[model samples]
Target: MEQAEIGLIGLGVMGSNLALNIAEKGNKIAVFNRTQEATKKFYAEAGALQSQIIPCETLEEFVAAIRPPRPIIIMIKAGDPVDQQMELLKPYLSAGDIMIDAGNANFRDTMRRFDSLKDSPLTFIGMGVSGGEEGARHGPSIMVGGTEESWKRVEKVLTSISAKFNGDPCVAWLGNDGAGHFVKTIHNGIEYADMQMIAEIYGILRDGLKLSAPEISKVFGNWNTGRLNSYLIEITEKVLAAADPITGQPMVDVILDAAGQKGTGKWSVIEAQNLGVAATGIEAAVAGRILSSQKAERVEAEKILGLPDTLAFPAVDGVAFLKDLESALLAAKIGAYAQGFAVMAAASKEYGWHLPMPTIAKIWRAGCIIRSQFLDEITSAFTKDPDVANLIVTPAFAALVKETDGALRRVVSTAALAGLPVPALASALSYFDSYRRSRGTANLIQAQRDFFGAHGFDRVDGVDKHHGPWGSGAAIY
Candidate 1:
């Protein structure tokens, strides 16, 4: 069999797009799918391209089709299928060959796969591919986890197919063992939170202002020009403006409000809780979806509550509302990042993977779905001080928070009075307040801790005394 420079398995939407992308970048590729027809169709579509690409009849044929010291990218579904694909490719792969799992596999599974393949000469990589099918076809943000040697082998291919973020390659050797998927898991979690926040904004506009979709689209478009500018906001404008084909009405009304998450969001929340980090925004977003799914309860709410028909905003005070909304959104966004970075920090300590938080933020600035202007500030913060505990503590962010706090509080209070749920915004403010006033709740928590764990409480005046461990102690003022 003729040897190809690169091999790609699972010719699905993402796989096919990536394979084509590699081919376009002047690399010879051998492509395979479970179904022969899919592979043939892809090759046929490749047609008269300058870059050589061959379709393989089976997994065995595909493996044989690649050269010695081969590099194969697996784009199969996560979980059992990843293992099955690895098994199928193992026989045909030789020593020094490298295999990359480019799916959303659980980080634990990646760790297991890495351990299982450690003794063998073949190398394994868990890669995180972001930017959806289109990004895969062109250039996507790539996060890779493997040994430095394995990364060196396929680094060229990865760099060639990755997008540029802030003048750096979006692709990076994330860290050793499962870091790639771990980061991707968090990425998806952030995506879930971002989408939900935007949905909440849409609800506020629809239910509170009773604005038409086009009007809402205009508001979002204006938002995209400011600090709130982000991929989610950009898409929100499009979603609002899009007209329904059948009814000639805004499609936003026809779309389902109940968002469906694909588990990563849940995983992030669980992981955050385990690490004892406050992931209020992500958790609230996930909870918002659950609440949205209660369609019957919501219908009953509309009937029983008899929601106001019209919401009034001062005609001359448009800027005030926009500013207030922006402040609220910014506060919420900061809380979300705080939660995500806290997870990264804890995970870094646990896994011994020193992930560059700034680089992660920079990579998300473009190509990825959650790209935002705020990332520039995050990247700057990390550049200035890599070990900064939280983005909220950064001087610039702190100043911004101070300036926005009054407006954010007003907006949240108004939303609450109007019977609108702004959980993400409210949670963000709560996190901010909690962090800023840590001393306020520390006493109560210490009392509870002493009650349970018999942990000695330190006096606010810097006096410390040891009580019998796990023994009941009187509260010390």
Candidate 2:
């Protein structure tokens, strides 16, 4: 029997689709699943395509069926399952075999796995595949972190199966070991912040402006035609317009208000804190999700304490106000991306990835949850200046902030006066404003810290740190 070019484990929704995608790319694929039934079902369903799929009932058979110096792709759940698969497949494989993980595992764990295989002849690759189930069967943006030799063995397959932006493949080798997954994590962090800002604007439309679901849906559809044209915005329009088949009510309205997370967003925020990066927009998004999860507590609190009264939403023409909301959302979106890229820059330095920011932006232009025209603009910015410390300082981006800053400030004010939560949007503006400041109020904070804990502060023109003395009767106070 001829050896299959590659092998894949797991036949779950994503895994199955990816296998088909690979086979369709004309490479013979050997496949196996822990459950024999899944293998049988997939083999039967493949029908006309079965000639390209080699089904194996055991790991030994799967390994033997693949070509020598085998490249195996694993798409199981992101935790212990990965380790278990590695152990199960190790004994059957020889030196120089490559193992590719396409799941959303934490980058730290990926690095640990990479280190564990350092002494062995085997190679490990932790890759990030974004875009949902449909994307897997067609094209998705691919981020690869692995050795040059390992990447060379499979680059053609990945590039062939990944999405293209203006005919350029969205798959690229970022660096060795956890760089791909690290970039993907921050991508999700920006996603969370982007989603929260959109939700805040939706809240302004739903309650403050008293617009109906369909009306709001139309507004979203309009936004998709301009700079905010993105997958999330396009979906928001559909979600708002959808009707429940049973109750005939708006689907979004009937759905639960609580948001559920799978931990990637939290991981991003934790890493930001660890690295001392000011990713305030991502931080607020993570916090907003946590707050949303406390549905019962929110209900009780609203009943216990009366809602505060504030100034009503402006009684301006709908078109004029929606334009402001658009500008507000655009500015916040820019801030979120700026902060996300800053985090990635820090990670690149700390990890020695030397990741190319322009390539990252190019890949994100399509086949990702956050795909947008703004990413194209970002690509242009990076192409012009690859080493910008912060995006707001770039010529193109600085001008953008100057144009939309007022709109953002206005929307934040309206949300505040209307007694609504706008954590992500507010955080974006505050972060931007804070970044532009030359002198801040931290001197007072430093003085207070010194007074209470004897912590030292640095003088602007002096070389040594300075300490402050407590005022008279400080103990009594």
Candidate 1: tens digits of C-alpha lDDT, residues 1-477? 457888899889999899988888777888889888888788888866534787889778888888868889999888999899899888888999988899888888999999898899998899989899878988898888888888988888778878887578788887888988888888888887777777777777777677799999999999999989987898889988999999898998887766676788888898889888888888998898888888888899889987754345324256677677777777777778767988988898889889988888877776777778888898898899889888789898888888888877887777777778788888888888988885686777776777666676777667567443444344442
Model 2 lDDT, full chain set: 0.91
Error of 2 at 296 (Å): 0.7
**Mind sharing the TM-score for model 2?**
0.97
**lDDT winner:** 2
The alpha-carbon lDDT assigned to residue 70 of candidate 2 equals: 96
Best by TM-score: 2
| Candidate 2: residue 273 Cα off by (Å) | 1.0
Model 1's lDDT to the true fold?
A: 0.82
The true-versus-predicted C-alpha distance at residue 473 of model 1, in Å, is: 12
- For 1-477, candidate 2 gives per-residue lDDT tens digits of 889989999999999999998888888999999999999999899877899999999999999999978999999999899999999999999999999999988999899999999999898999999987977888998899999899999998888889888999988999999998998899899999999999999999998999889999999999999989999999999999999999998898898889988888999999988888999999999999999999999999999986767747666677878998999999999999999999899889999999999999999988888999888889999999999998889999999999989989988988898898899999999998899999999999988877776677898889675876577633232
What are the Cα lDDT values of the candidates?
0.82, 0.91
